[model samples]
Target: MDKIHLKGCRFYGYHGAFVEEQTLGQIFVIDCTLLVDLEKAAQSDDLVDTVHYGLVFETIKKQVEQHKYKLIERLAGAICQDIFQEFPAVQAITIKISKQNPPINGHYDAVGIELERQRP
Candidate 1:
């Protein structure tokens, strides 16, 4: 299996269990890694045979920015599902979502959740 990774995508979103968090919003960072078979694309050097990374980035951005969720778990799951649907070549996906300066009364650069899914 071959891999494609996208890291350090930052966006501001109002997602949290707390009202203050929802109203104020915070910076969220997203990372995605996907498993794919690169042999065909590598041989043909055709965009059609391979996944369009721009579209993947846009999908991740849209999923993160356009919707509200109380848990990163759900957000991550939704992203994986969307990617699987959008890119049939994606055999598996791993996504991580992080919020910097979480309201948990601790000094941390970011708090995050990571999950992986394989196509069924």
Candidate 2:
């Protein structure tokens, strides 16, 4: 499958289990892989034939900024669902989200979750 890959898409969101993490907010980096068949777009070179990545980016941004979740897992799921709903051409999607400088014990740069889903 052909896909549009977006990496290091960052957003500040108040999403976490802890009070400090939610109230203070933090940077979240997201990597999205949107799967689709791009043959028509590749051949026709028409914007209508393919999904606009700008729209996708905006969609993600809206979701991340507007909603609060206790877990990145839930956030990932919500993102996946939104993408699939808005872009039916997508056959599958992978969403990876990370919190920078998490509050876990010891020294850790970040903590994250990667989830993939496919249309039935």
- Which candidate has the highest TM-score of all? 2
- Which candidate leads the pack in lDDT? 2
Each prediction's number of clashing residue pairs: 0, 0
Colliding residue pairs in candidate 2: none
**Candidate 1 TM-score over all chains jointly:** 0.95
Q: What's the true lDDT of residue 74 in model 2? A: 93
Expressed as tens digits, the lDDT of each residue in 51-94 for candidate 1 is: 88889999998877898888888888988989999999999998
Give TM-scores for every candidate, taking all chains together and pairing residue i with residue i. 0.95, 0.96
lDDT of each: 0.88, 0.91
lDDT of 1 at 97: 90
Clashes of 1: 0
In terms of lDDT, the poorest run of 10 residues in model 2 is 100-109
Instruction: Identify the runs in model 1 with alpha carbons over 4 angstroms from their true place.
Output: none
